[model samples]
Target: MKVTKTSSNITYDIEGLDAETLLSLYRNMLKPRLIEEKMLILLRQGKISKWFSGIGQEAISVGVTMAMQKDEYILPMHRNLGVFTTREVPLYRLFAQWQGKASGFTKGRDRSFHFGTQQYKIVGMISHLGPQLGVADGIALASKLKNKNQVTAVFTGEGGTSEGDFHEALNVASVWQLPVLFCVENNGYGLSTPTNEQYNCEHIADRGKGYGIESHIIDGNNITEVYIKVSALAESIRKNPRPILLEFKTFRMRGHEEASGTKYVPQELMDMWSAKDPLLNFQAFLKENDLLNDVDEVEIKEAIVHEINEHLEVAFAEENIIPDKTEELNDVFKPFDYQEIISENVFEEIRFVDAISESLKQSMEKHDDLVIMGQDVADYGGVFKITDGFLEQFGKDRVRNTPICESAIVEAAMGLSITGIKSVVEMQFADFVSSGFNPVVNYLAKTHYRWNQNADVVIRMPCGGGVAAGPFHSQTNEAWFTKTPGLKVVYPAFPYDAKGLLATAINDPNPVLFFEHKGLYRSIRQDVPKDYYTLHFGKASMLKNGEDITIISYGAAVHWALETLKNNPDISADIIDLRTLQPLDTETIYASVKKTGKAIILQEDSLFGGIASDISALIMEHCFKYLDAPVKRVASMETPIPFASQLEQQYLPKNEFEAELKALLAY
Candidate 1:
């Protein structure tokens, strides 16, 4: 390792960083402080609605960030002015962002400092707490596996130290030995509660020791110490990818962003710390060495002030505000391309579970950007061994086996994608998707809007009922995620379609949630393409052509539809398999029902609001005249999926597939 470990107690290193660096540190601190002070005044004067201040802890951002390469990624907390400025974001951009101008990042939807520049390799700054730590973990892990030379810096507060994400990220980072710099700005408070209230640990650096990674506690106010220590830390992590903690002992000078009225902070302590501030301290150190004089100081301050106002002038003068529609919409999921865009799918005979596994193998072979992570996904070859041989074929690095932390896994996917790496996240079971919902729904779903960014992050899990999976394991929670717009939901019923749909979902420009139903993993066989191919979303498959009735279904229900047609030839059937739900194939459904003159929606999920509801609603309005009879749905009764074998069989859409057809035949 090229990185030599430094002492924990050391607080200063005078020469590794020289006069120019010191002045730059001083200049960096002053600019954020000046902008923050100005923005605070703007908020008070009604010129700006709100702002968060990074007043006291400036040196950590300045020192560590200045030492890093331009291509390195930075995942920052809310109060990281020095780090943000260090990453090349102009003071005016920050002001413009605070003022809510469209020219601002994300064309004005996100606050300034929310999304990092793609050109600069700075990852988006998420507003939510704790999760970004795990996000940073994923990025570093990607770099480690892909052999990329970039390092990632993740910021969090002492309060976040108590969060599960914080601990999970550190554990994963250290275990994987990922190149990550975990900077915890312990500004003595995690909001109103003191560090003492949230944790008993003496220092954030101490927590790193528990993970067996290198750690340091520095005088966060000292520019030289922060710079030299972090440079050394970054060097080691970059080479060997181990988690490192750099805890800056600083204070949050201003009250937490909007909830402010300063009386709670004792005046005397504030005044004392104000006198020893980072900018003033760095300036004095430079002057003592005769590296900076009165003339340079005056020019630097003037230049920064001029830049802030110049950006603000454009920000205020530009009438670029996002419209009300985009405020609620935009970048949720990449829009789904309908049927016309699909390359034809080639069919081959194979079992469904093996079909699902083969798709995983094909994707792993196809894209350098594609990656898979989950428990038993490696040597154990996955619980069902669908991902078996992947670790041997692609190596353990690519087919990663994680320690069963769903939130961390999902957050890592978010962070990894932020760095331009497309990820495929898997859980041992679909039931486990609950653990990852916070990052999936709150962070990943709203990320682009919140950060004003774009990324293609994918999550695939085995779901649905039947096969005696019981309550916890067999779940069809597509409704839970289908409600979240940014995520693409897919359910392929046959071997041929599974291979093609999985390929299509992988290529989508937005986050996709592929629902690989456990029930149909290997119920039967079909001809799937031996070569690579794709199937577009918002499209459906016509299983059999008929005139009397249309059976609309997905997942296992589609198979049931085919079985029903075998028993009843009198009722001619047209079965449509809805591969992707969110961007549904309404056109195909209506067209099929129009021709058939009657329609039936079938699903393996408990009735109310399933894909059947959405599909049936479209028919009642658009295809009513085409329908000779009322539309019907064959779905599980409104009850939890049962555990008993006989009840479970009776509970699902089995006999109904035939019964619905017979009813249509009678009509």
Candidate 2:
């Protein structure tokens, strides 16, 4: 499988490739080109909204896909239409998706290229280009752990290499030696910016050396060269299980999209690249080799065009199916049979951090596919020492320490989850979760709704501000995710709740943000059950029952509420601890509020647009008639957590909660 260089073009030792396989590759390239041309026509006629063409880059898609096994996964970008065709994805399904019909993969929830079908082992692209690289790495990681010989091929453009996820994915893949092929379709221009402007490297493949991965540069227009090189690389990767960075030097003949005219592209440069179009060049090559006669060429063209026309006609004739309004509320989280847990008589007093670590250990023991990955999580046992001794128990393969790439960690976890391997990702600090917010909100949270795919990932976020960890270290970012539609946000107060909630989050078939208050990690210790048990999400635990007023809180705020109640012996209030925030325990809160006829909502986050606002509104909406006084909210002031101990204490809502509670009781 050696490559031979020539003056004008490259040749590969592809003597084994028969005429039939060569013809099939050509057809694969031609079919996409014809379909893209039809898509442009549809756009002009106002039949479609937009299109991203893979006119000049079809060789890379067809070549690389032809090299892959049928069971191997493909995470495709918008321009990889040839990959879809090679995977045997129906042209009608693609058309139906473009037309926003329910028959499509996403059931019309997502249109165009933002969709994927599990049936084809393809995960469609999100708007962000780089995250899918990490996801592909995760899929490969899963394959290695499950003892499956599968490689995951992920596509990105030259522009996408600029993203941090590109570096993160390559580094992780190389370190773990996962079987993944990173296909960088270096097609000259990223939207309007050329390669020189996007990167300083001579070639995108040059960066692979820094990550210690095998890399190669191939003439993407030459189908034979691409197929031979990629096939050899894919075969080697399956045996050795290491990532290879392969850069395909090709061009995009059209503008980025239909509405984006060719004004940005220079005519001379376009003319030069257009001559090297993979479809036309391959057609000429076949004629030169006497592999494709004129009749054979005409027949292939007619057959492809006829198939495209038939699919388009049927797809266009079909009614565009809008999802039912009720469906919008559904599929945010997969339905689970509620399992009742009987508390065990055996109990052990454990710290909050130990509870989390124990739950992760138990989950891993129960499900062999559960993987824990994060910064300093393996050898150092994490910055908080929550995962201490985990590496010894689970080994480095399952317990992994990753580079400081929050986005990649979460995105990779999503990929693993999609492939039936549940992953737990720990952000070093909850405040740092903002770095990975794009994937968390756009991909992980939305995957279930978009394609009915279960992104069974649990993100362990150590949140809240109490210790003098300052603005960067101690910030409560729960409100940010709580506002997002398809995420389950859980914040635990004590060790008992922490263990149960984390266990539940690991088993749930959706993305769960398990927030452990850093302040309470070592401080809170209680006798938690030794036996396995799960706490139901969207349920509240009552700490105290009183007739005068109700105090509703979660996380560290719940402890403050309990302490406030203890000090105020005369003030009788019902205290409720909401374990999970997204599926809020409104019924529990409403019942407590109805009984007391007064309510006070509290949290550690900023006052404006915080969880308190939502709880206050909920009480007003559901328990308005039962209330004797207006629902009050006590939350941290609208300011960043200060570094000084005194300022931080003043900035928090501990004192505020007591005052608000007394006022409510007095009223």
Off by over 4 Å in 2: 1-14
lDDT for 429 in candidate 1 is 86
Clashing residue pairs, candidate 2?
none
Give the alpha-carbon lDDT of every model.
Answer: 0.77, 0.87
Clashes of each: 12, 0
Q: For residues 127-230, write the lDDT of model 2, one tens digit per residue.
A: 88888998898888889988888889999999999998899899888888889999999988888888889999798999999999999999999898888888
Q: Give the TM-score of candidate 1.
A: 0.91
Best by TM-score: 2
